[model samples]
Target: MRQNPERRTALLDAAIEVLAREGSRGLTLRAVDAEAGVPTGTASNYFRNREQLLVQILHRTRERLVPDEATLTGPFDTAALLRDLVARMRRERSVHIAMLELRLEGTRRPELQAELAAFHGAELSENIRWHQDAGLPGDRHEIVLLYLAMLGLIVDDLTTPAVLEPYSVDGLIDAMVARLLPEQPVN
Candidate 1:
């Protein structure tokens, strides 16, 4: 019932670890509190129930997964930005793994579907902000497509290396970016 920012974050980290290690079925406030090494009631103090805890996981994943805006700026270097994105994904791999697990569980749960939708809406808002900041030409629909494509690529890059040479990370990113953005004249 009490709010402690640091403990709440610790609980979220523990939840991610539990989800990654044991899947959504392992995610309960008691489990999270135990994993966090906090008191038995700590996680429940922060999250009302399992759905609420899962929603927090989604929020934390969105917060941790999006490429930092400050890092994404300066030049329109799709390859470099994507490289950075991949690096972030690798560095926070557990969070992403948990997200993937949640995405699967969401298919069977309506509350989770709503929470996942909010996570995606937040992601799209960030994409739109990045596009506007970079002076990129894509509107929301195009951005949505681009985001989905890149998400697929990210999952593939993390799980399985490109089976085809043309689909290698660099080639894949270049192709995705080229398809999304309008052509520019040579300098």
Candidate 2:
């Protein structure tokens, strides 16, 4: 018998909730099944093992956290986009923490590491496209560096909330624009 799409989505949602609440170390198929109010066999039917379940949860997270393709196009407000991205990080604090924990776990697991790298590469590609549409110079390599730096700043701000109390996401965007864009010569 085929599983219901809604039930599958519910299971994934429950998995994320469990991950956010318990961190990677605490996640288990039994726990997810319990959280979803389903039988253990049901959860097992969908995800044969813990690793498969984790990969699905991470993939769902990427689906939720990453902006859609339409939103990446130009003619939209770049500052607003940056603010939205920062706000997403702030709002999904638990998820972000869980992701960090999973990343650390990935160090010992080559498959998980490769999965994360692919996700990062995709994010970098989208960011590069956004910058290119905004008339920025340099290739994907330069753009990826800038993207990683921006992510680092956001993560730093989140980790040390007090250190950047006065700085807003807008300020970060301004700094990035200043560094990445060339100044026009005064006429």
Candidate 3:
């Protein structure tokens, strides 16, 4: 019922921390309120229900994780771009973990599943368009594969980093980029 933009954003950010710390089963309105340090019913005032909360969190996570425009539009090659992406993910580790939580939760809720699918599908399309428009060395299909590969890399790096203990994240990123995109000369 409240329409304060700053308060709503604060609540959503608190919810993200809750999801990251407690996982989906522990994400309750009370937990969000506690995390936000707001009154008991404050989150309820901002979000109509758990589903709405989850949806809003989804968008908020994307907003938190988006790379800077200069990083994308500046003169950079495909490998550099991928490295910047990995760095961004590492910098926003909690947000990425919370996003992973949402994805797992989506598997159990059909409506949430649809939301995740549509959101990620559109995101993938946009990435492909950006790759082409930016003159990155890769086709749509390659970009799609790269997306899938990086997603796996991200999961490993975030959830169970030990699984990749043998190789650094940057090394894996270089390997993935090499396989997915044509070799570009360094400037």
lDDT of each: 0.80, 0.74, 0.90
For 1-187, candidate 3 gives per-residue lDDT tens digits of: 7899999999999999899999999999999999999999999998999999999999998889788878877577777877888888888888898999999999999999999999999999999998888878888889899999999988988989899999977888888888888655779
* lDDT digits (tens) for residues 1-187 of candidate 1: 6688888889999999999888988878888988999888888888878888888888888777766777766867765677678778879988988989999999999889987887788767977887777866566677777788889887876666554345567777778777986555557
Pick the lDDT winner. Answer: 3
Please give the lDDT score for candidate 2.
0.74
Q: Which stretches of candidate 3 lie over 4 Å from their true place?
A: 183-187
Model 2, 1-187: lDDT tens per residue?
A: 2378788788887888787788787788888889999977687888878888878777877766877676666666545666777778888776676677668768988998898889767766776786777764546666666677677877776678776778775787867756754453556
> Candidate 3 — worst ten consecutive residues by lDDT sum?
72-81
Write down the TM-score of every candidate.
Answer: 0.84, 0.80, 0.95
Candidate 2 residues lying further than 4 Å off, grouped into runs, are: 68-70, 133-139, 183-187
**RMSD of candidates 1 onward, in order:** 2.8, 3.2, 2.4
Best-to-worst ranking by TM-score: 3, 1, 2
Where does candidate 1 have its weakest 10-residue lDDT segment? 159-168
